[model samples]
Target: MSSHSHDPHILCPHCDLLVTLPTLKYGQKANCPRCKSTLTMRWQEPRRRPVGYALSALFMLILANMFSFVNMNVKGLTSEITLIQIPKVLVADNYASMASLFMVVVQLIPAFCMLAIIMLCLPVRLPGRWNIRIAWILFHLKAWCMVEIFLAGVLVSFVKLIAYGEVGIGTSFIPYVLFCLLQVRAFQCTDRLWLWQQVSPAPAIHQPLKVGQSGLSQGLRSCECCMAILPVKQQVCSRCGSKGHARKKHSLQWTMALLVTSVMLYIPANLLPIMITQALGTKFTSTIMAGVVLLWGEGSYPIAMVIFIASIMVPSLKMLAIAWLCWDAKSSKKVDRERLHVVYEMVEFVGRWSMIDVFVIAVLSALVRMGQLMSIYPDIGALLFALVVILTMFAANTFDPRLIWDRSGTFENKEKFDDGQ
Candidate 1:
């Protein structure tokens, strides 16, 4: 039984096991013994590494926006689209929502995240609790930074365009790719635990904690935003001022509601045309599956599979997985807790990739305009499909993975389960 204001002990966010963090050397990491979640890692020169990568990433992003991203040649008529023009073209086509999505996920979010990492890691003096506010926004927005996914979408779009004309990478293409890599590396180097610790030391634990047991049993919980371990009864985090629960309150109900709404949107997203092609006075509307089939039939096997997996298979299976997780969390039947935990992690990891199709549409619509000879325009279905992806992502976030380990017969303390802590 011991306590410290800056405690070395941590509660695993996934399984809630309390463990003492060891002094990790360079390139070493600590994992939770219970559910195999990576708790923390010690990177080589964490401060300098993230700051450098973020700075480079921001520079690359600037270059990406300044020049052409891709060029298409058809019958000696050429069209080139810049990275910044993607959203503007979508807006011109009257698809404001899809345009906003593209702008936010592809550019704004990644840029902000990189800047946040730089500010936090560097010795910058911000005025009046700005650090805490920035840190909060940084961690929350980190998951939504989809630059890498957008890059993948761009590659798929290029492959799809190979049949229509000679598709070539433009001046901005390599810079954007480098931007994606640098931003991801910068994010990986900036650890949430480390950042929160910089903002404020972790709150003290006044009670005894068992190393190999659940935090709930010890009346403790981890803040989702800052990873600060605190008493279960404390609703707001003392360190980061974030409101949290031992588990997400009514997590199942909220997740189920979002899942239901997303499922409804998914039906129309599949049925309606996502893209419109205008060529030689003929307009052709294509649904998601139709596009995939066209790509496959045209011998673009890899790109077709990528589209099918990202747009169709991933969303459908993710919804089913979320529903199954809710069931497992609620039911009293003996469930494989570890396997369920793995499934929840996978759902979180793959949920955002579903937006790749929406990005592909943006790229195609922006680059393939030839004034009625050949042009691509986004349809209503693209907006609906984007909404579906966002709704599912929110569903995944609202779901509390810790609940999967909270069922009866899993933990040693039966009273904790009965009390519903």
Candidate 2:
């Protein structure tokens, strides 16, 4: 209940509530009273912790690229693949879309995010604009880094390969696993507010702010790029120069547009073959459902369920959820907004996981290359499916969760409060 006028204030990104931040002890966090979105966190030794973890993660990432990732022996014929070779094989097979997706999500994004963390957390000085640019890119790209998802895909690939022949761990496997863990830890340690404060100071607010009030009512808005609180009239943030509106303009329109596109792409993605396998001079095409059925028929129920959930259920349900949210936000009828907010959070968290199936295909296509005995190649459906996942993720990003709360009468009334109130 630190309501002192001198305390720093922030507009909650979730519900646009302007909240006064209290001094937090180590390992403490502050959440918005209205929507419960985490406002800020106080980590112990934030700078040193992220730097160490990022440095270790970078070293592990380098090691992961230098050696064999997985080795398999099929009827005395052996095949091994390196971490870097996955994309190379896809490119060689002319599936550059899958290759680029694999490389960007698994390797490049993670590496760049870790490097950015180290640079921002360390005492090294750069131009203010450069620091802001790097920080802006870092936050935006961090969610897309899927090293952990790739690791999960690799594990699922191993289960599928166990039925084929003997599979063994490679020298690089441990390092890659370590890299995933360290990179995630590094990201967790790097607080968003702390990094922004270090790179550029928050803009001064001359007006009085009260906790538990909506920023929209106070004529204030938060910059999505840097979390800087600014007057609603200011369309551009002074800190990062990212243009924003009180709410994302036409958010529902953009979300529905992307959702419609995803549904259209999802049809082809399901009907067409996702992977082509050549075995014993016979070619077999597997669609998404066909692959799941084959895995189940092979007695790999858990792995089959994993694919079924990640590829099938997640994308379908996520789209439905987005459509429902858009409708709920538009309708005048009262709904449990808190529950909807929870659903929104879940949607955001699970959207990226839909990429797991694509990554699994990339792994299989790269490692199961034993000439005619066994080989897997990406088909058109893999690309289509990948696009569906990306589109749905974009849809989720465009739909502002704050809109769910904007219809509340409380915020509407606050809009009329006096400036000195």
Candidate 3:
């Protein structure tokens, strides 16, 4: 009698081996059987119609900037203001510094970045230098756009404005909301990794051994200098002195340092007011938690839940996960590698959504400027809040999740290849 086992159904891209597909839930992933290369079966591809949506969004963004965001009336005084009016008001009011910062970060930069992305994805030919520059601009812009943060700010301001006096939604507000959604849709459509792939030069491919006694019939030939490799398994090459393939591990100390810093910042981020409002020469500051409480008390349960999740829960969870992973790495703990990887993935996935609070603040500040009647301004806490979210996100990205498996020694020697099984 022969003993038999079921074969996996996964196809490894690195080794071109069809292996068993691990039982994965919707968001789960698996590793290759032969090459040990990780595979994500649940990865989402950009939608096909995102380009169309992006174009529509671009139009809406232009319209939103042109029209007024809010129309407010207080005690027989009425004023209508557009989204672009905010910067003009700031500049005219001699708050040049704030105005410049606001224009660049909140308005000009985001608009140009979105426009650049549209240009890059458009079916048009641009000069190589300009194309490359725009591509780089888009890369940086993707991180700084902060549309979600803007949305959150808008909602918060709306609530505050409605609480005090009459507040009417302007034409610009509708388009601005659509613009945010459009930007998200555009991003989902245009795959950043794929765009990067397109702009990057293709790897130079060399002809494989035709009939020579090259003694190179198995593995890959990789450039040690650049790690450029043909996917096949090869022993040694005369050109590059690279041995078996091994990924560089992230420094444990650096990861731990970042995790510690994230933990330290987490306290102040929750405790300190993320936004302060000044009304009638009196200032009111509200921490992240306070804001949640305020919203909950106001019967805005849905928005409160959103704020609780995005601002409070997600950031705290991300920091803890990073810290745990780093601790495991430092202590050389043999924890569940797959589970650890999943946690890391979850952190990365939710990191950006943490900007929801920031978005709310921005939108609110822009919309609820009613002169002496009602003025909305960002508090010092917003800066710290943004910093906490950004720093934690960076920490999550910097700390390699592979360290979890490396410390566990669960990874087999990747260089070992059998000639005859």
Candidate 4:
């Protein structure tokens, strides 16, 4: 474990355990002993990480958004789908919320992240406060930007549409693909802690606390905003200044509310048509499962499986997992604390990708709008599905995984066992 004079301790974001970081080689991750989340990651040439790639990605993003994404020609009637027009067309079709989210995830967020990276990586000094805000914003933004998943959705939509009409790849398609790849590579190569160290040279240490004494009894608590270890007596985080929470401030209630909303939307999301296709004055509607079945029938088994797993299985699993965690943490006695923490992390991470189907419909709906001969429109289920994805995401975020460990009694005894007998 490495400790400097400036900063001697770090808090586990998952389990709220104070830890001293151990040095690791490039590509190695230091896992928290309690909940097993990656605490520290070492990547090569941290100073250069994601910078060159971000610049390249920025260029690719500009090209990708500036030109049409795809061209669809049906019975001599041609329709071109531009990246800019996708959101415009969506709003025109009264899917304004969907349109806004689509643009934010696919374009605005990624662009902002790329720009933030470039700014952070430049050989220049920036104001520490702005840098911290940018870094914090980029961290959250990464989860919301689903360009890779959106690309997968587009490919699935392409396979479905190619059966009906001629679909031409556009000039921007290659760059968009490259953008996803490089964007992912950039993040893979960047170390978040490394970035933080660079941006904020000064670090404040959290007051130590005996783990066994928790709740209102002990001053120890995890900062909800920055995940920093803080004394409960302190109202604001020494790091992020978010109001300190002895507990997550009604974590269970907010989680349950979001989960309930997801439940209400889930049935409609599955049963209603996700998209409507009108061709030669004939309208056809396809629900989530219907689309999956269509792909299966068309011999696109891989794509079908991807859609079913992403659209059906993933969300189902996330909802069940979150509900199970909540139930077990709040009431059950024999629940494995480590397993619950892992499940909570998985649930939080996986919920964002449910937008895959929504993005697919948006892309297809934007690209294939031909007035009389052919057009595609997102259906009611698409909105509900989008809501389901969104609600679940918020549900996961509202949940505090540390509560699981606290309920497990591990915290109540850690101090007694701190030393080897």
TM-score for each predicted model, relative to the true structure: 0.95, 0.95, 0.67, 0.89
lDDT of 1 by residue, 217-330 (tens): 878899999998889999999988899899999899999999999999999999999999998899999999999999999999888998999999999999999999988888
User: Could you report the Cα RMSD, in angstroms, for every candidate shown?
Assistant: 4.2, 4.3, 9.4, 4.1
lDDT, model 2: 0.89
Error of 2 at 372 (Å): 1.4
Q: Can you list the residue pairs that collide in candidate 1?
A: none
lDDT string for model 2 (175-214, tens) is 9999999999999879898888888777776677765677
What's the ranking of the predictions by lDDT, best on top? 2, 1, 4, 3
Error of 3 at 333 (Å): 2.6
Kindly list the per-residue Cα lDDT of model 4 for residues 139-203, writing each as its tens digit: 77777878898898788878888887898889999999999999988877777666666765433
Q: What is the lDDT of residue 400 in candidate 1?
A: 91
lDDT of 3 by residue, 148-187 (tens): 5656656665665566667787878888888888878776
Q: What is residue 176's positional error in candidate 4, in angstroms? A: 0.9
Scanning candidate 4 in windows of ten residues, the lowest lDDT window is 412-421
